[model samples]
Target: MSPRWKWKGAEAKALAEPISKTVSILQSSLTRTEASGLLSNHNVLLSVEAEQAELLDRSCFGRPVVACAEKEDKRWIQLTFEEAFFLFYNLNCIKISLHGRRLENEVELWRFVRSIKPNFATSYKAYSHLRLKNWIVRPGLQYGVDFVVYRHHPSLVHSEFAVLVKSVDGNDRLRVWSDSHCSVRLTGSVAKTLLVLYINGEEVNREDMNLPLCLEDYTVEEVTVRRWSPELNREHDLSL
Candidate 1:
């Protein structure tokens, strides 16, 4: 009985709403029913609009939800709380049901997620910036980072970068050399660049305060790391 959207008939109310159809929250992952509903309906929208949308890339407009493999012929629209919040805040998609009642607005969603992770505000700011850049961002827990960013939809290409968000305030501690090295190498192994994003701003005391508005006042720096080795750096001879 976690929060879910109630859609009546065939088409969805909004472009992003289709992704919320039949969604249920368990543990922190958002799951969507795979049978005929928003998923199928969304595909039809893509088909019908494919020609009209030629001026813009139709692939990017479908839905932002990610489907994780559950079993044979089955997949779930699993997303992290941060990812869900991003969709809610940026796209205004997905109606959440909490305790059988719908939450009023983004503020309620912010408070709910903040209760789960106190560091949500900082991460949300960083996430919104990256999303605004048109990068496909996803939770990067397995990679020991905050997000994995792809140049395009994941279905179209592999993620190109792993992002780690760090506070820029003087109180924040420096990352361990070994940990940084490991993260860089791991991301390289998977064909992704490691990007460390530093969020510069004073910490906020109220969850009700708009985080996105404050993002404009904050500065972020992107740092990419790479391993340098003599073997890897060796130059190859060219045939005349």
Candidate 2:
């Protein structure tokens, strides 16, 4: 299937919610309460449709579900807050509802996501870029990075890259030596490349934040870190 699809009015209503998003169980029949019960553990989305369930099957966005209703037909997939925000603002695939009402534009969506996570704009920029590249991007908290990128779906293979997103803003401090050292060890242990992605752009002007934020306007420099073991470097050293 193509990675993108349009949502019908009814479909939007069934999946999007106001305070937070809620997805109804559509693939199978289930009450709203049952769907809500399925999302209680994951603080991502408020609910999900049981039929198109993905989160339970795999850790799509890096957020894992701890406890969910057991019935197969009763299962649903809820996008975490970050996932919902990313879908609406970055991908332009889904619209979100607010308190029984649908949002009018991207600005409103940006406001909502920012209100929930103060650093969402920065995080979203990095997220949007990787996602647009079509990589399987998931949370990287476990790897001491911003995201774990899979060339193939997570279920099929281990992640190939662990990404750390950094901004151009001087206010953000440089990563300490210890942090970098630790990240290299952690990612290496898991057989993943550590990519430090430095994003260059102006600080977001929330009031003037435009819809369809042009990611091209910004730039990224990806630095890959690898531990230099003397044993592994012997061949190169001999050549030198």
The local distance difference test score of model 1 is 0.54
Query: Which ranges of candidate 1 are over 4 A from the true structure?
Result: 1-76, 169-174, 206-213, 229-240
* Backbone clashes in model 1, listed as residue pairs: 3-97
lDDT (0 to 1) per candidate: 0.54, 0.57
Question: Residues 64-164, candidate 1, lDDT per residue (tens digit)?
Answer: 22343333433334345655565455655445546556667767666666666767777877887886776657778898878887655454456788888
Per-residue CA lDDT of model 2 for 1-240, tens digit only, reads 111212335334323421121121221222322333111223344344444355333325424244865565444345655566655555344545665566777676666655666656667777777766656678888777778886544544567888887875533423687877888888888788888788776665655444436454668777888888878776575756
TM-score of model 1 vs. true structure: 0.60
- List the candidate 2 regions with Cα displacement exceeding 4 Å: 1-49, 54-75, 170-174, 203-206, 209-216, 237-240
- Model 2 lDDT vs. the true structure? 0.57
